[model samples]
Target: MTSLPEDSPPLIRDNDRDTAVGRLQEAYAEGHISHEELDERLHQVLTAKTRGGLQSALASLPEEDAGTTSTIAVAGGRIKRRGAWRVPRILKVESAYGTVRLDLSRAVIEHPVVDIELQLGTGGAKITVPRDAIVEFEDLQTGWKDTRYKTRRRPRSGGPRIRISGTMGFGRLKIRHARR
Candidate 1:
């Protein structure tokens, strides 16, 4: 990914009221945007004072003309699945502020992975792993009460030695070994 320069302008732009309204209408019609959606977007754009706010709203609502695959929500959250698991090689995880991943591990197969190296960006987590699992020490920076892990369920498969490292702000991470 191309990194934006520190001095570069923000992704969200402040649109003039009249021009923005016109574009909203045009996008609503030729773009086939619903009146309700357009109104919501208009409200967001109007209320947004900073470029970040404007950009966030725009990113959440994509251009009507451009779209590929729809998103399916899982575990009361939006999720995406990759290829089927085969011997469970390596799990590549990346995340930003306030986002969590791997919500289906406990729900799906029990202890299907043998090894994992978790490289987190900036976020908090509450994770549970099988008991008797060996974890390795890794280089990481974490915040106070940001990570909590615990294990309650019985162990199905021998959990891999998890090594986690990353920078965090304000959150809690919990890890515990569940006895199966």
Candidate 2:
């Protein structure tokens, strides 16, 4: 096999491409970039073959903030958050024996990525996300019941990404996208 040129930039992986695309989307959503600029940058990221090319596509975007995080812990009562609440960048929820309800259909979310870490014991959670949001729960572990979420086959573009993780024992997690 012929060796690649020493000056050739390293090839990028799919995850790298995805990360770049996600950053572009976040910049667009936060009004840091115009629609036309987002389109151009996205195109560049998608077609980039090397790490250098990908980096060029994201060179102008600002760095993501570490952001504020809040945690709610309950031993035996329900925890509910609804009706135009402000959502932080990272939210940690721990419930021992009660249901947790979070309604984000009409809430205020300024960040592009929201992480919800749940540690539940003998309880469950119901989460309602915005219609355009994207949800990922690949890191969640359940002991008795599985999570209940009907994922859209094609999620809409330019929405916040909600990542759910942690362990649940003897309970279920029901997640739904809002209708309005």
The CA lDDT of each predicted structure is 0.47, 0.90
- How well does candidate 2 score on lDDT at residue 149? 96
Which regions of candidate 1 deviate over 4 angstroms? 1-87, 101-122, 144-146, 149-159
Model number with the top lDDT? 2
Query: Which prediction has the highest TM-score against the true structure?
Result: 2
TM-score per candidate, chains pooled: 0.35, 0.74
Residue pairs in collision within model 2: none
Report the lDDT tens digits of candidate 1 across residue range 1-180. 998789866453322443355456666766657889888877977887666655554553435332122222223232234223222334444444444444323433322223333444445554444355544333445655535544335544444445545554555555555434
> Model 2, 1-180: lDDT tens per residue?
999899887889765787788788889989999999999999999998889899999997899676899999989999999999999999999988999999999999987778999999988899999989999899999999988999877789877888899999988999999988
**Clash counts for all predictions:** 22, 0
| TM-score of candidate 2 versus the correct structure, residues matched by position | 0.74
